[model samples]
Target chain A: MIDSIQIRDFRGIRWGEVDGFKQLNLLVGPNNSGKSTLLEAIYLGCTAGQPAHWEGDSFEPAQVSLSGRDFLGDLPLLRVLKRHRYHLRKAGQGPYRDGCLNISISSPAAPLRRFQLHVPDLPILPDSLRDMDSKISRIEIDEGAQVALFACASGRDAGRAERALAGRILQLLSPTQGAGSTRQKTVQSGHKTPSGPNKQRRTAQRGARPSSGTAGPGQQTAIPRRPPAAQHCIYLWYPDLTYHSAGVAAWSLTGKLASPEHVLFFDVSNTHYHFYKTFLRDTMTRVPGWTYKIADCLREVLGIARSFDFHVQFLPAKDNDSLIQGWIAPRDQPALPIDAYGDGTRTALKILASLLSLVEQATADSPAVLLWEEPELFQNPRMLNRLLREIARLIEGKPLQLFMTTHSLEVVACVAMLVREGLLPADSLRAFRFSLEEGTLRSSWFHADNLLSWLERGMDPRIWDTLGVPLQFTLKEQEEGAE
Target chain B: MSAAMGGSIDAFYEGMTEKKILHMLMQRGLLAKVNLCDGKETGKTEVNRRLRDVVGPNVGTKQVRCLVLRDLDERETMERIKQGLQTALQALYRERGHPKAVVRFVRHRAHGNVYLHTCTELDVRVALHIATYRHLPDFCKSTIDDYVLRVALHHETAAALIKRQGWSISSKRIIHKVTSEIPALLKQNGIPMMGEAKDFIHFYAALLRVHTSPAVFAEKILHHAPESELREVFAPLRAAAEFLQDASSPSMPGDRLPA
Candidate 1:
């Protein structure tokens, strides 16, 4: 579990640091305050060297960003995300330029298990997309040297960026061969000795200069950057996609980011909502046993009295493919199509199922992470309360850490109440408030103690910054005004 | 927000009464147009925490002028104001994350006031204005009711509110208590002056005996309190408001307050 997270110049956040994550980390703030962006940064940080997005079919709007064939590398993503960024010219000053973005996530329990991603605000990705390779990500626990992220515009660029990353990985792990990065094809390669002094000197030298075009937190110390023959670097990440084990073979990642939590960012942004069906279809095919568990979770959280069996049915397609259909078949009752249920149900199912799967696959060594955004979406207060309790229950004693974001202060209160009731661990809920300005996105993290205190004293911890001020919401025509 | 973004001032007050009162002053152009965020009565620590919370959104943008109106639940005097709240202010920014931060109460030749100002490490200019709400500035430390009574009882609107129904203060007993009983009560307490923070406590106690709802009574007085009276009695709030409006350094109240 990533107990702490720090991001500087990632999306709308110029500089933000929030720690004290429990099993459930709550990101609470107003709109445009960079709560969602914080989640995205964690997701990207943990999954460094992995493709940040997969656009799938251009025509298919429902196609999720992290899946399918059309993967987008750093340059392409920069193209998509460049406009949302600004240049923090000074400390808490200046318009957000396309400056470098860095994200560092660490587990306090496992201090060495850290993942840092730094994408240098390269001048190259802004205009021309066809030529650049996004070998920019450096994940040195901190370089990735955390994300030396290079940019590539399309799938065509992905292939090139992938090889460049693999070659850089080869150079970092094996200095003898890394010295040959200018000539050697680092793909399909085996392990070599880790040269501590050589790597340390190079890393420190690179780390010496902070956000310059030439220097950074040196992670992969020896990769000759932007080589002419970028294509001949290596082809390694493709085979490593399924390589989700604790043992990281080769990549910008050296020891792996946190024994490597199977980091999954469950984003519910309007465009990315289509993945629930895809998730259900895959789960039914691979782990049909999870159906009953998911059903039980859904039933208990939704306060449904009756038992049900969550299932996905297959039908013959016009092109001889099996068209998958999902259903919620209640025990001793007629089967109902999953489509008949509301988005809240599906969203819960997605979360519950993912939790179950991750928990089942997780071990003491490698815990799983679920980066859930907007858990309150379409959820009534009662349902939300139940769902939160259910989540706490599901992850109890299990190796699963949930980092979820919600615009609802109700969620913070609910979690506090849960901790109060002993349904959730008292120390395991960290509520962070993100307040955004021009060159800064400030994060204030609250422990259970603060939450309980705020609630007890009639303070709304969610808007702590505006608590003593007369904002529109706090400014009310109440009986207290007479005082 | 840089130069492109407009500036903003937000005041963090202890209770809804202070909020409505400040907002009332803002509406009357007696104070700056401040975003008044009401605080829970968790005391001094909560005030400092809330100030810390507002620092971030302004750290990298156009600096947001902050005015903290925490009712430390005590009466203020010029000696205490002059001694400076640097220790308290220093405690606020001394947390681990605030790097090389320094807090200084604005050095001033101004009178004994309830307000203090300091810049945090992030350079968030925050001014802390003490909300002195007491039954008697010398006697009992109390709620925002004291602030209401202190400012409003001096205004002619207090008599109007006494006569108004459902707005509290109904009978001749209450009117006598406000106009006659309160003065006699203060005299009974061996008090020589009327303007101390303690004096409001006596008036509030009299109104309390009449079953006057503090919130309702405060609202009526704030709404109907004359411009001149507010400018005079609420000069501290107005000072902080004006400080918020200006781009220059923060200034303390030049006017004196009874210890």
Candidate 2:
């Protein structure tokens, strides 16, 4: 576990640090408060450690390589990732400070491992990647096929923007998370960078920009080199579209990852229908009678009196696409397609299945990581609380690190209530609200008692600014007509 | 609401009484938010625990402040505690064969105002108030009820409430005199027919021969009081509000806390 994390000049966060770590960390706040960005930085910091490697043989011609401690770090902008400046003084901020992207993390594995990379602020490349000059044209044909496929699914515009800057696609392939493979211990989505070396790691020292004119201004200017001791080629599931009814994430990570110590960020691009089917199929192969357990979980969360038979049916769609759909119904009743059920059930059932998968595969040596963006998506307040309680019960004793974000009052209230009722261990839960103005980012943690105090009294600590318990401050007596 | 990345003031009023009083006393523009203190829990441990909830692990890093409002109860309660302790000690001494015959009584002085800048050890500024009846005894500091009494007696809101409740006054003249000189009567000369309770609402209920809980009656009296009259005695609250406006940084204790 990353016991402590300090981020400096990483995207929106100028300087911030979370001193403590908990098993179930809830990063919460208003939208764009660096909640997601903080997760990305942690992913990058943890995966960008020393002795890292990337295989661009998947691409051609201009084979790009970058793993030198003294590699001249440029502001290489990736069309896939959101970009921001290192120093831009906004209103009320004091002054601009000079710094680069640096995330220093301290864990039992690494006492003081510093992950530093500053993509120098680069100007926009002149020509779109598809219409790039011959020097850059040789790369776009197969520029990170995986990146382009998902980048497009992420949204229409992101895909277009990515192709326009195909020259920098190799940089995105660096897999900015969980470096020094052996130290990572846990696998995300069953994708493993087999443990090798932890010793051959070095920081990227600043070297002046190359003085070659082979690539003009606003064109590809990356210095390629051979790969180093390959380590931590981890996958980071962009948490952007993890909402309900979305397609499966482009990472074919839903394969047989029945291994413990897996870190899965569920950003299903498809509505988790087929993704969970394959995932559950994998889990069932390893753990028999898992279907019955999943049925119990679904029954518990749905709050239905009758038992449910949780099963997936393989059905062919009109377009001839094979759609593996779940068919859950009250026992003894005709099965109904999962599409007939509310999206709430679909989402809750999906998350519960995913969690059960991780819990069954968990190992004592390594605690699996489950990063859920918003567990309250499509959940009714009553069912959401029950779902969270089931979630709380499932992961209680398991060696799993659950990091989730939410804007739901029910989620906040449920955690506090569960903690108070002794259902959720108070120590295991750590929540913080983030605020980032311009480049200066700030964070405030909500202690267990704080959540109980604010929430138990009907105060929404997620939106903690509102005045609590409006008072009756009457002035003069009521008017003559008033009762 | 979105602009304030910094924390707002966490006004830890003692209970609903103090919370209601503070809400009406301090203007909304100056006052950010008010929180009810833990249910009557006392001691240094509870204070630290309470402060930690607002000031999480991000102590010095986060700009958060809280005005912890607890009443400075009457000196009589302290005397009662001492008497009780003395009685307990005597019983133990009698059983253990120790001397208890020459027990001398000592009356400690009452606390005027307690100002603790505990923001260092504790993460935020803590302000404790003593409700000052400006014309009352010099060393007197009663519970928030006393201040509620001051606001209640203002323009005789309590008197009007008494009349509206339709309870018979034990002595018509005392009710008439109470509507104006209630604080002086509460301080120097106790009200006629009203018992020894420090809060005027109890005294008024007693004099009026009304049978209702003080908590219920206090709520009634506060609600009946004019907003204009309540603002008259809200000086200390205004000062506290101004102090809490820039709560991001813990500053020196406000000079006129109990104005």
Candidate 3:
């Protein structure tokens, strides 16, 4: 388990630390109190080495330059540079050109492992492409020192500019082997092969231009461009591993990020109906045992009897598209389309289906982490209570860590009740109340015993004032005021 | 005056018996002002343990004095209650580290009536008193209830209620039940009668409005009753109030009452 997390200069969070984490951690706060941001922070810290986990949209630059007519083509490179500059400025107010994200994790038997992702300064645009509407001249691509520079010239040497641009982009996407280990192959103008070692070597040897003499105006020479000034590096420090690499580091320390088979995140607000149907279909086809278990869980928590069924209609062979419809059958009633029920039912089904799928894949050696945001939405108190209880039971013996954020006091109260009844151990549960102070998020933890005591005293856990010390009054004033 | 002397007299009670008694004393002008501790027996005991810590030994040459009142509550014997009181007093004295302080029984006569007072000397002065309600000469068993019933039920409306609700029931019991149920009945069926009947119901209507008990209603009545009205209602309680006033008054140390 991750014992604690300290977040700084991430999103709206300036500096905040939540320590003493347990198997189950429930985050409760008012809306817009940075609960979702904190979840995103944890996900980012855990899976930072994976390029897929780093959402490109969240790192968009504050300002976008719209001068280039081919600005859309330059967006990918521009976005990367702009994000680096934006974070470098936001990390601190200085001339610093690099921003670092420092993440540290530890297990029970191993020492702490710290990973640092240092975003280097934005690459400078070549002189040719600096002017507006200037056609590309000579474009050079280099793989030395893990840096690729693009140098282009404009005016009369504008022939095959677009093709040269595409070639350079293709080379950038493919993996570049070490500097002097040359097993180079070449790519002629209009042929691009998908991934393979041969394709990678061929793409690298081709660089950005064809070797044919009459291919284009500036395609004759293929001298390699020098590496850029600033280089992005990821540093990893652990007991057995201490290395820094200039490219995205392969997360060899954990298999989950490398494969990403066990981790799941459900944002109910953005999930589409088709996505949930697809998930249900996949789960039913892959793990037939979990279909009944998930159905039982839904019935127990939501107080609704429902089963998943897919209606398939096969047409003529010439018409290759077949229609498959998924419906939820209520007991002793006609089947209704999954969307016919309320969003609450749909959300519960989506969340439970995904969780059951994770449980199916979980092993004793490798546990899964499920991050759920706003499970309390569209759910009443009774439903929320039952849902939380069922969730506690679902992950009981499995190696699963559950992290959820809720604005419902009912959910918190139910968790407290479970803790009091010893269904969930006091040490296994951690509850934190988040509040915004001075534009930064701050959190206060409620010990399980203290929370149980408060509930036993018939006090509302959400109201902190009720737990304060009783008021003391002077005798003379009380007597004088007495009727 | 006693106000110029910094410390003031304070009273602690197990319940409302001493609180009602103190109100009567203040109304009869026997005591200028008495500070009442605002808690029950357990809370009052905690206050007593912490009294020395709060007020210190003396406040500018005037020592803080306290009066603790308790009911006999039908113990096997009055001696048992007195022994319990003595043990509690000793614990308090020891806790305050004033073991050698003097304790004496002082008697005061006012309006041809006698009342007993127990005085103790801690660094700050203290006193303890007992009210054997069933044993008091004029104010007999349930004195406060009897006083409230007499004042509220002597009107013609109450007499009619007594006659209608069956005179076999005690007038006090009928008044208690009527006062307890009148507000709810009025809310359900509206006011049934007019004039003095309405006023009689309105007088105890606070039972529902504030969710207070019959005991609390009686205390509120005694707290707000005028001196002449209280004197007419219970002369023995008035005499006891005079006795307490004379005992606590600095000016009445010797021969302060009329013969």
Best by lDDT: 1
Residue B156 deviation, candidate 2, in Å?
3.9
DockQ of 2: 0.13
Off by over 4 Å in 1: A3-23, A26-261, A267-290, A306-326, A336-340, A373-385, A405-477, A480-483, B1-7, B13-17, B39-46, B49-64, B70-96, B131-211, B249-259
Model 2: per-residue Cα lDDT over A142-201, one tens digit each: 212112011111111112222222223222222231122223221111112222233212
Instruction: Estimate, for each residue in B73-95, the C-alpha lDDT of model 1 and write its tens digit.
Output: 44545345334445544554454
Task: Report per-prediction Cα RMSD to one decimal.
Answer: 14.2, 16.3, 23.1
List the candidate numbers ranked by DockQ, top first.
1, 2, 3
Fraction of the true interface contacts (Cα pairs closer than 8 Å across chains) found in each model:
0.22, 0.13, 0.00
Q: Quick one: how many clashes does candidate 1 have?
A: 64
* Deviation (Å) of B14 in candidate 1: 4.4
The chain B TM-scores of all candidates, as shown, are 0.67, 0.56, 0.51
Interface RMSD, one decimal, each candidate? 6.3, 8.9, 15.4
Measured by DockQ, the strongest candidate is: 1
Model 3: runs farther than 4 Å from truth?
A49-260, A270-288, A305-326, A330-335, A455-460, A463-483, B1-259
Candidate 2 per-residue lDDT over residues B1-259, each given as its tens digit: 2344345566654444555555544433334555444433543234434544544433443445556555444454433433433443334233223343332233211223333333332233444444445324543555666666666555466557666757444334554565546656555775443332244566666765556655444555566677666555555554554555654433543443344
Q: What lDDT does candidate 2 reach at residue A18? A: 57
Task: Tally clashing residue pairs in candidate 2.
Answer: 19
